[model samples]
Target: MKPELQLSLQFADARHRGALARHRVARFVRAALETSGRIAVRIVDEDEGRTLNREYRGKDYATNVLTFDYEHEPEVVADLVLCAPVVEREAAEQGVTLEAHYAHLLVHGTLHAQGWDHEDDGEAEAMEARETELLAALGFADPYARG
Candidate 1:
């Protein structure tokens, strides 16, 4: 059974107005959740994305997705921030659909909120395996598959 989720979605960047519906986002999130959660997912433009990344992660550029996880027990409480333009660029570069990319990132962020990480080779492999499994279950191709 999928874990219960209370999701609050926001689109600071209107460019993705019709793309990321609440049900779709929730489906992506729930697929990676091992516990119930209160998650806020925000989609932002490059500037806001860069600013948040710079302030929170000390990185000067916008990243695809950032998970600010506050809790992992009983219930996971976190915020997932996705950079829209970056995601679009990546999808185009990777030859994947925008919907597929969004699903991948939401799953990635949800896993992070549930305490998954890819800080090293072993961790990365495991995390990727998990992500692959989850994505496949959702009928998506392996995100890390080599061409």
Candidate 2:
């Protein structure tokens, strides 16, 4: 059996959009790593997303999600900050289901927390392929699958 992991989901919005998706996320992450840890997912707006991405990654744009891997001491404490607007826009433009897209991004972010990066072409290919397989196993469509 996979180890126990705790998750906390926060939303900057007044509604419960992320709350609806939390269980899927928890299932995805836990099954992927098969480890014991604590993770927090925060759904934020553009401003906060931009600020954080800039501060931590030195990127000035508001990306979909930023994963902060605080520690890897078995009990992991990481933060996944997702921008709602960006996610929605990407979902529509890419012609993917919101739930499937969300699953892909969450898996992508979790991989980052586990020391995966796509900084170069070789690394990008490897990570992207891994993400594709993981998403498929999670019952999600391939995010990189073109229509």
Candidate 3:
């Protein structure tokens, strides 16, 4: 059975959020989940991103994507935080379009919300493989592929 997705998107940084449309974001997220519940995808500036990372993860800098998994089982529920500046920088560094990078991060965060992790080598490999397949299905290249 296909999962039902309930996505709520918030833009704390409006300047960088419009590059990715709401429908595209939802499509990428839905492709990564096995079953659906609800997800909140918030695009934030460096300040809020750094604050959340420091508060929740002990990191002092703004990261590209942060996934907070609230539930996983009969239904998947979570929040995905994407740092706009970080994402833009990374996209430039990786020589990919902003939309492609957003799609990859959305897929990555959704996987995390569904209880997928890359804590170890084996786990990372499996998770990355799944991500690649899903992205390919969505007409995106492998996000981890070297240039």
Candidate 4:
């Protein structure tokens, strides 16, 4: 069953605007939803991404994705921030399509919004397995797979 979702897609960085269409972003996010949710997916430039990470996570560099989860009960509510440059670079480095990488990140972020974490070995394994399963269901290859 597909979980109900209300998604808000924003692009602070227009570089990847053509790549991230509203319906496409919604599809990626919805694929990871286990329950009804209100999620905002924001695509930002390196500057904004770096600032957000520095402020929120005390990290000095731009990251691929950041999840600001507010609620995780009957309905999940959260904001997912994706750094365009970082994602693009990582996709190139990993030899994957930009869309594929975005899908993986969205699934990973959505899971975090629902309280999934990888702080430990066991948690990391479980979360990665779940992500791989969900991505596969969406017709994506295992994100953690290495050749």
**Candidate achieving higher TM-score, 1 or 3:** 1
Per-model TM against the reference: 0.98, 0.89, 0.97, 0.98
lDDT of 3 by residue, 25-119 (tens): 88999899899769999999999999999999999999999999988977988999999999999999999999999999999999999888999
Off by over 4 Å in 1: none
- Clashing residue pairs, candidate 1? none
**lDDT of all the models against the reference?**
0.95, 0.81, 0.92, 0.95
Tell me how far the alpha carbon of residue 15 in candidate 3 is from the true structure, in angstroms, after superposition: 1.7
In model 4, the runs with Cα more than 4 Å from the true position are none
Candidate 1: what lDDT?
0.95
| Worst 10-residue lDDT window, candidate 1 | 14-23
Which 10 successive residues of model 3 have the least lDDT summed?
14-23
Candidate 2: residue 100 Cα off by (Å): 0.9
Tens-digit per-residue lDDT, 99-127, candidate 2:
77778888888888877899999999999
Candidate 1 on 1-147: residue-level lDDT in tens?
A: 778999999999979879998999999999999989999999999999999999999999999999999999989999999999999999999999999999999999999998899999999999999999999999999999857
lDDT of 4 by residue, 74-93 (tens): 89999999999999999999
Q: In each prediction, how many residue pairs overlap at the backbone (N, C-alpha, C within less than 3 A)? A: 0, 0, 0, 0
What TM-score does candidate 2 get on C-alpha atoms?
0.89
